[model samples]
Target: MNKELQKLLRQINDKKNEVKSLVNDGKLDKARAAKEELKALQEKFDLLFDLDEEEHEGIEDKVSRGTAKVIGGEKADKKNLVKSFVNIIKAGFLHVEPDEADVKVYKDALTSDATPNDEGQQGIGVTIPEDIRTDIIELRRSSDNLEQYVNVEGVTTKTGTRNIEVDAESTPFDNVDEAADFPEMDEPVFEPIEYKVKKKGGILKMTAELLEDTAANIMAYINKWIAKKTKATRNAMILKVLNTMTVGKEVVVSNLDSLKDIFNEQLDPAVAATSIVITNQSGFNFLDKLKDSDGNYILQKDPTLQTKGKLLFGEYPIVKLSKKTLKSKQILAEDGTTVTGYKHPVFCGDLKEAITLFDRNVLTIDINDKGSGMWEKDLTGIKVRDRFDVQPVDKGAVIKGEITEVVNG
Candidate 1:
C-alpha cells in the first residue's frame, strides 16, 4: 500500500499490457523487446510487494517505539537498494553495450564445446535461437501438409529411413474336398519404402555495426529469416513426394461423378474415419459449385474438423491448398469437341497410413566469427542446417483422384 510499491506495481501492469498489445498487432519483434522490459518491472514489483508485507508483519509490529523507528528506517533503506538494482537493469535494457558475461552466454548458446569427432575435429551442434525456433514452429503449424497427414518418426542419429510392408492380396476360397491339396500358400512380399534425411539451411552475414547496435532486436530478425528458409525448403520436399506417388487408373477422376466414386470406392474403407481430401484451390473451387437434386451445395462446412477452415466434403475433412504444387491435365467431354475443365490430382486418404517422414534433425546453427571471410568485412557468419526426408507407403491407402474443374456450359 506504500506509495513507492503502488507506483512500481502500476508500471509492471502497464508494461505487461503493452507487451500483449504488441503481440496482438503481430509486431512480434516489438513484443519480444517489450517482454524483456516487463520482466524487469515484474521483478521489481515482486521485491517491493514482499518487503512491504515483511515491514507490516510480526517483527515490526512487536518492536518498542525507538526500536520500531530504527527498523522502519532499515526497511526504507532496503527498498531503496532494490529500486536502485531495478533501475540498473532498466538502463541496461535501454542503451548499455552487452557486457563480457552477456557475450560469453551468447557464444556458449551458439557453439558446441563438447568433445571433438572421430578425427579430433570440433563439430558444432549450432543451437537454434529460441525466437527462430518459435517462428519455425508456427510456420510448420500453418503450412506443413505432410505432417498433417503423414507418419513422422524422429531419430537422434544422422542417418536413417523407414520401411513398410506391402499387404498381401486376398486368396479365393475353395470348397474343401476333405483332402484337396492344401492350396499352395502364397508368400508375403515386403516393399521397401525408404526415405533419406537431407540437410537444408542457409547462412547470414551480420556486420559488426549491426551486432553492436544496442537498440536492435537482432535475434528476432535472425530467427524470422531462418524460419522462412526452412519453411520453403520443407514444404517443397513434402509436395515433391506427394506428387511422385502413382495414381491408379480407377481413381483418376474426370468429373464430379468420378470424384464421388473415388470417395466411395477407392479410399481405403478401413481408414475412412481419419481420411482427408486434398486439392489445389482451383480444384476446390470447382467442387464448391457441385449440387444435389435439391440444388444445395454438396461441399459444406463442418465445425468439428481440425483443418484450418473446417471445410468438409461429405463427412471427410477437406484441406484446400492455396499452393501451386500439384500436377494437372485438361479434361474434355465424351464428344471430344467440348472442353469440360482441368483435371488436378486430388488426394484422399489417411496421410499417416500412406506416407512417412524421416527426421534426422530439425534445425542446427553454427557461427564463425573469426572466419577469414568475416574478418575482412568486420562481420560474423551464421550457418544453419536441417535434415529430413519424406516418402509414400501403402499406395492403396493414398487414393489419388483427378478433381475435374468443370466449365459452366
Candidate 2:
C-alpha cells in the first residue's frame, strides 16, 4: 500500500510540473486536462492514505479506534468509546506512569491484543500493558447505564464510555430503544468487563515519577500523534471548513485541485512552525509554560496520558503565529516528524528547501524531490525494535566512517 502511494506521489509531482510547463507553452487544453486528472488522482490518493477512520476489517482496525468523532446515542457512544479506548492503547497513552523508580525514561509496549480466544490468546494489538488506566472517574446516565473516564490526568488519551449495567431480572431488550428494530438476539448481549486504572501512589509521588520520563516519552507519544492526527484532523477540518464555506449548498471549493494539493501537501507549514522550536527546547526552557499554578505541566500531571489529535504549544509562540489562530490552537505537524512544538525547533519551506533547512547539509535526498510518501501514509506506528526492519546488519555492527585525505599539516 505504501509503495503504491509513493508511486502516486511521483505521478502527482510529474503532473503538476507538466501542467505548469504546458501553461507556459500556451497549451491551455492540455493544462486543463492535466488539472482535471490531478484532481481525480488526488481523490483516489487521499482515500488510500487518509487515516480519519479505523479499518475495522483489518488488524489495524482492532487496534485502531475509528475516527475521533465517534458517533453516539446511548449504545453507540458506549461501543465507540470502547473503540476509542483501544486507539488510546495504540496511541501508547494507555501505558501510564508506572511506579518504577529505577527507570528514568520508559516507553509503552507497542504490542496489541485482538480477538481473545477461549484459551486466553489472540492476535496482539499495539504493545500497551493490559491495564494502561490507573484510575477511572465514573458517571452514570441512568440506573442501567454508567460512563467512566479520567478527567484531570496528565494526558487526555481516554475515551468516555458508558458501562451497560444489568440486573438479574433485566432482559437484553430492557435497554434497547425498540426491540423490533433488530430481532437478531433473544437474550441480553452484555459487553465484556472493562477495568478502570488505579493509581499506584499519591498525586505528588506520581507527578515526580512521571516527570522523570516526561521529556522522552512525551516527545515519542506526541510525534506519533501528529502523524495520526494530521491525517484525521485535516479530513475533519476540511469537511468542517467545507461545511462552513458552502453554508449548506454542497458547493466544492473554488479550486478543488489547489485545496487538495495544500491539504495533502504532506508538509503543513503551520504545524511544523508550532512544534519545531518546542521539541529542541522542551525540557529546560518551555516546561514552565505547560506547568500550572501547582508548578506542573498540565499534560504531564499523570503518566498514562497523551493529548489526542491536538498539538499543544507554549505562550511565547503567540507572536510567531501571525495567522488568525493564536498560540496552542489545535494544529497538525507537517509530515510525521517528532517535533516538540513548545520547545524544539522545526523548519518548513519547499520540500527541497525544507530538507535542506531541517537536515542542513549533513543529509542527502536519495530519491530527490520525486514524490515522497504522498499517499496512504502511515504517520504513526509502534517503535518496538530499536532499528527499522530494513536495517540489515546488527545494530552494533553498523559503523560510520568518512574517507579523509591525509594532509601534511
Pick the TM-score winner: 1
| Cα lDDT of model 1 by residue, 195-233, tens digit | 566777777777766655442245555656776676667
lDDT of 2 at 56: 20
Model 2, span 305-369: residue lDDT tens? 24221122321121112122111212235664533332121111121111110000010001111
RMSD of each: 16.8, 28.3
In model 1, where do residues sit more than 4 Å from their true spots?
A: 1-125, 129-135, 143-145, 161-163, 168-189, 203-216, 247-250, 305-308, 325-342, 366-382, 404-409
TM-score of 2: 0.18
For candidate 1, the clash count comes to: 3
Assess the local accuracy of residue 274 in candidate 1 as a C-alpha lDDT between 0 and 100. 81
